[model samples]
Target: MIIRRFSGIILLAASLAACNQPQGADDAAGKAAAEQPLTAVTATLPAVYYDSLQVTMSAYYQLSAALVKADTMGADMAAAALKYHLDSLPVARTGLDSSRVAQLAGQASGISAELEGMLIDKNGLDGRRLAFQMVSDQLYDLLRVTPLKNTAIFRQYCPMAFDNRGAHWLSDKTEIVNPYFGDEMLHCGSVTDTLRF
Candidate 1:
């Protein structure tokens, strides 16, 4: 009877040890996983492409605002802005066929020409506004697709460029935070927010 009791106690202890061993191993694994750095996933867009897209979008908004206000000074500023943006477009051959690059550049050129006309003509407000809206719509549509393709590229290549710099687009007379590390919050509009005529 005593031998039976001793054997039972030894079996129970062994069972408990076996159970505890797995728990310890699991705990260690959990800790290791927690400590591991988040593996940076690739973005869909390259930094150059992403940045160019962002700049063009920003210029579109600015030009649209100028058109609505009939602010000649604003329009002039936007012309320079648009020119600068167009100049900054990524020209590097990123495996894209020449035909595709030419097509994109042609679209950009058309937008630039519209902006130049708006700036040059004193009475081109109505025509300018229409052109601005058309260009803005086209760019936004392109962006919807561009955002997905370049997501991994932008995240991996340009972390700062992916941040929200146009948060003020929804607010009425709100200050917009600069995306590229600036102290000033640019004063933007809620006009685009409503999408109303």
Candidate 2:
């Protein structure tokens, strides 16, 4: 009777141990799946969306690089270039429904206006950084729905950029060279998300 009781106890312990092992493996698997690249989120978009987006992103990179180098004039020129591309975005090029395209255009128009005003503002580098922040927020929304193909756009953040409220920008590269702080804290941000095309 004593041996039977001991055997029963051993069986119960083995079952409990087996149950715990699978749960741990499952948790690890879940994390691995969640960490995968965001490439699968993109859908087929119109050619104009891709072309204009690429041009606009290139202009943004120029502005970011200029800020990193602390060149206000360069930033101005880059912002102007970005504005030009933003204005040229074709509204009819979206494969999405008309309502969705209109929504996208509305957002794009907001970004353009901010960029144009920033170009005229004399508030200097601080003002420009703030303008860039607005542009980034709007552009991020637009890109979320119309992602580029075969490319990875990184959304980066700098917690120290604007009065400690934080700021975000998109980059084709993963390296962080903060535009808000310029050379004061050039590498002050990190890649928050990698949106792959």
Candidate 3:
């Protein structure tokens, strides 16, 4: 009778141990799953958007330089260049769905119409200057509010070129120090500082 009781106690202990083992294993698996990082959404932006952005940025830089030079001719030329690029941007041929691509194309077309009116009116230097500034400001606001604001990929690609610093905008400054193009000096030394010629 003593042997039988001891055997019964051993069997109960083994059953308890078996139950506890699975709980411990489940806890470990749960921890590992919780610790794993989430996958990023794959980027699928259309190429036309990139082309438009590049053209717009180049036009902005050129217009800024022209403003500094006080060259109405140069400013007009750059504005015309901007208009041409904006007009010629092809509808997205790949990536995005048809409806989305159509919407983007329509927006581009509207922008092109506004630019065409500005160019055809021969609105003079001041008018062109104001329009250029407006475009630049709009692009800045768009970048702040859209993909640039939310995506790590955009942050990695489109580094900040300038930031307002007290009395001037400083450019080419960032935390991750680049060995080649270290902090670029601000070009606000004088009215002629940014003029190419």
lDDT of 3: 0.44
Residue-wise lDDT of candidate 2 within 1-197, one digit each (tens)?
A: 99999999997676434322322346447745764322222457777678888989899889888877878899899999999998888866766668766777787788899999988885788888899898887787777767777799998877656665667788888887778877676666777678876
Name model 3 segments beyond 4 Å from true: 1-42, 46-52, 137-197
lDDT for model 1, please: 0.45
Give the least accurate 10-residue stretch of model 1, judged by summed lDDT: 153-162
The superposed Cα distance between candidate 3 and the true structure at residue 135, in angstroms, equals 2.2
lDDT per residue for candidate 1 within 106-178, as digits (tens), equals 6557656666666677555545544454455344333433442322211001112113211111112333322
Residue lDDT tens for model 3, 88-144: 655465365586556555555655555566567766655654454445433333333
For candidate 2, report its TM-score: 0.76
Candidate 1 ranges beyond 4 A from true positions: 1-43, 91-93, 141-145, 148-197
Q: What TM-score quantifies how close candidate 3 is to the native fold? A: 0.45
Global lDDT of model 2: 0.76
Candidate 3's displacement at residue 88, Å, is 2.6
TM per candidate comes to 0.46, 0.76, 0.45
Each prediction's whole-model lDDT (CA): 0.45, 0.76, 0.44
- Which candidate number maximizes TM-score? 2
